[model samples]
Target chain A: MSREPIRDSVADLLADSGLADDGVLAHALESLRALCPPEAPEPSGALADLLRYGSEAVGAAAPSRAAHRAAEAAAGNLSPRVAPAVPLPPRKLHRGAAISAAVIAGVGLSASGVAALGGVDYSANPPQAEVRSSAAAPAEADASVPGQASKSPDATVHQAQAFAAAASGGSVAHEQPAAPSRGASDNALAGDGAAASSHAVAPSAAVWRSERSGAARAAAAAADDALAGIGRDDAAVTASQGAPRHRADSAPSRGRHVAQEAAAVAQALVAAGAEPIKEAVALGQQVRTVAPSLAGLGSRH
Target chain B: MTDSLTDHDLVAGVLPETELFSRVYQSLAPAVLGYVGARGVEDPEALMQDVFLSVLPRIGEITGGVAGLRTFVFSVAHARVVDHYRRVERRPRSVDYDPLLDMRAVPSAEAEALVRTGQTDAHLLIGSLKPEQRDVLMLRIVGELSVDDVASVLGKTPGAVKQLQRRGLKVLREMVSEGVMAQ
Candidate 1:
């Protein structure tokens, strides 16, 4: 083939190369030349010299790239290799060392450890005379149905007496039932009056009875809630200053005993001049009635 | 007239460690940078490094001596562009390429002074085209890819590229002519 034809064919083939189309490449190059100057970065003298030195060194160097690669490969393979197993911390292997130590100490002094850990005295039991007598009396009463010996002021009291003796040699009972009477009043006002006065003294019993009076008031409230459905606006009811008429009429039917108990208790509490005891008693009764009514409402809901 | 260099000969002669490769780097690095800059690389020098690194292995495959090597380096740079985009795709798209990075040529301090002083209406005119047209035009002009390359990249045909380019140029020309006529 003629050189001209050969060159033209070669140029055609060059155009055919998938790398770039001649037209786009030509335009791009032209635009690049126009846009960017060749002398954009002035090379530093030191950098130029470094480059020259590196190039000259490579030109004259004895070790080829392949040889260098081989040497690097050999170094990688032949060098002594040590991958020591990571030393695990003692805590990692024995996860709960402190807990294990505690367990071991507990096991060594088993009974004391159980008591200490449980926050109780295992050697010294709560004086069992009361528990034994109480447990025996229940069985004895079961055997003899007519005997009311089990009801004789409770074995729990004697146990309390014994505990009191142990606590401070029976001086606690003598020093004051009055101080504990306050505690008794709180206990009496704790639940329904029977439950309240279960161990309550005269003062606590009076307070519990007043709580029964509050029950009268609450019964009146419940009757009102029943008639008015408790849905009546309190503002309107309070503004009216009277309960719904239907409840007002029926209040006496259920409230007479509660009222009598309340008045008597109130008189006793007033005589004693224990306002907190009186209030607690009153609130207890109120709570008793309210609870039932609230329960009824809940059941409906 | 020419002894086509083998890979071994090329590695020994024209690689980075050799004299010929350094000369090629000095001569072609700027042109390659300009090419990449024109296509909107923020740092064309970094792009030039990438191009050379890619082409270094396949230097002997390019047939026509230094100019041929230059073209091959550009092709490698173009491939690097595809790689850059792939990397960019992996990144959060919320991070935007800076708009200033699109300026291929930064004017010199003197030229900038003069240009600022001059009464000029120098603005991006491509904004006049519809979004699709502008996209096609930018890909063709700045990407320096053929119609087929653009089509393949866009999942279209060369015919589609030609049509869009024609329509976009026509609309731009009409807008300019209309503005001129109005004046």
Candidate 2:
């Protein structure tokens, strides 16, 4: 005769989470032991017990003394994990690197470790020679040269105001944020020098739905984007503006150039106001005051 | 017990070192084994041991005391689980012939446990759920990690962890109700 056994898993589940104190989840999973049921192998030795509960908790058996030895032997030099030393291949210069190195060696280094040969030496302090250009370069539409407004120390204040005017139109326009997305400025207002048409209005909301050609609509949208310091998408601009898609003469390029000048002017003003360079600007004022006496002395000699 | 100890307090009170690592291994061994084993990692015990070997180097420097150690340990275990599947995908899962692994010599737990009865046990019951539910349950129940720790270890949000936990518990609760009704 054989006896049948009963095992209810729902009972098992309740019993498993019976230790869970998590108010709601307490009956779900109370303790960790439910995960590793009694049917799992009992740790036989200390080494194996490393993957088992502490020997003290289970009270299964006395931890074998060999466990310590095995752990130490197994774990020897395990701390401060060092990467295996990979055999590095012999160092050889690539063709571009070889050519650059050859060129540098031919030029050699000055005592200051800058290249003795002629390309720009960025490490040197900026040239302090008085900017003598009677007219500014066309980088700036209003003043031409960016830092030219600061021709003398007295011109620093005017330089800052000029930057603000160039960037946002004036002090009042500066107060208002440049938000093209908000439709604050409906037409070309960036003062881009090459804005072709004064009449190129931002299309009204209904105009996009009207039966206008795609090129006409896109050109109007592209003009608005160009003036707002937004995208410089070559394809969109080329469809409307007569300039080649990628050329610097394009309306997008002119807008970008104007923005670049505004930023340059801002940078020059910041450099003029920086405390590190404050003393240098003051020295310029001192030299200006002393120059008349030096001229008289030179004339008599 | 660790709730009162802030991460800073735990680190301030104890030095990170080998002794702490031993304590960690002693505490987390069972959980790691159950977690990796349930996830169906190849050679679960060996991989569990490898997790410790990796932790050995960081033994002294591990912070947040036991809770921090558990999170760190489980994070490694989770990564190893992912890596195991990745390896199985990249290369055909093959191992050198070992008699110990042969089913003819030794029947597996699932093969012995409920295959004979056609009844689902806890492992099979938990396994029935989706991977996310299973991960949340395993990390919550076996690893005994808080929802936030589970989120960090699993790289999920706490809300997501909570939702997964709720769904998993609901499935298990339904199974329990059904089993009771059948009985």
**Which candidate wins on DockQ?**
1
Q: List the residue pairs that clash in candidate 2.
A: A19-A30, A20-A30, B16-B60, B17-B60
How well does candidate 1 score on lDDT at residue B170?
Answer: 61
Candidate 2 per-residue C-alpha lDDT over B30-85 given as tens digits, one digit per residue, 9 for 90 to 100:
67887887787767876666666555444445555667667877777787777778
TM-score of 2: 0.37
TM-score of each: 0.28, 0.37
Would you list the C-alpha lDDT of every candidate in the order shown? Answer: 0.42, 0.47
Give the native contact fraction of candidate 1.
0.10
Q: What is the C-alpha RMSD of each candidate to the true structure, in Å?
A: 19.8, 29.2
User: Which portions of model 2 show Cα errors greater than 4 Å?
Assistant: A1-32, A37-301, B1-18, B94-120, B180-183
| Highest-scoring model, lDDT | 2
* Cα distance off (Å), candidate 2, residue A269: 59
Error of 1 at B61 (Å): 3.3
Candidate 1 lDDT over residue span A86-164, tens digit each:
9778878687887898898888899776766766322212233233333533533332223323322222223223222
| Model 1 stretches with alpha carbons more than 4 Å out | A1-33, A40-301, B1-19, B64-71, B85-183
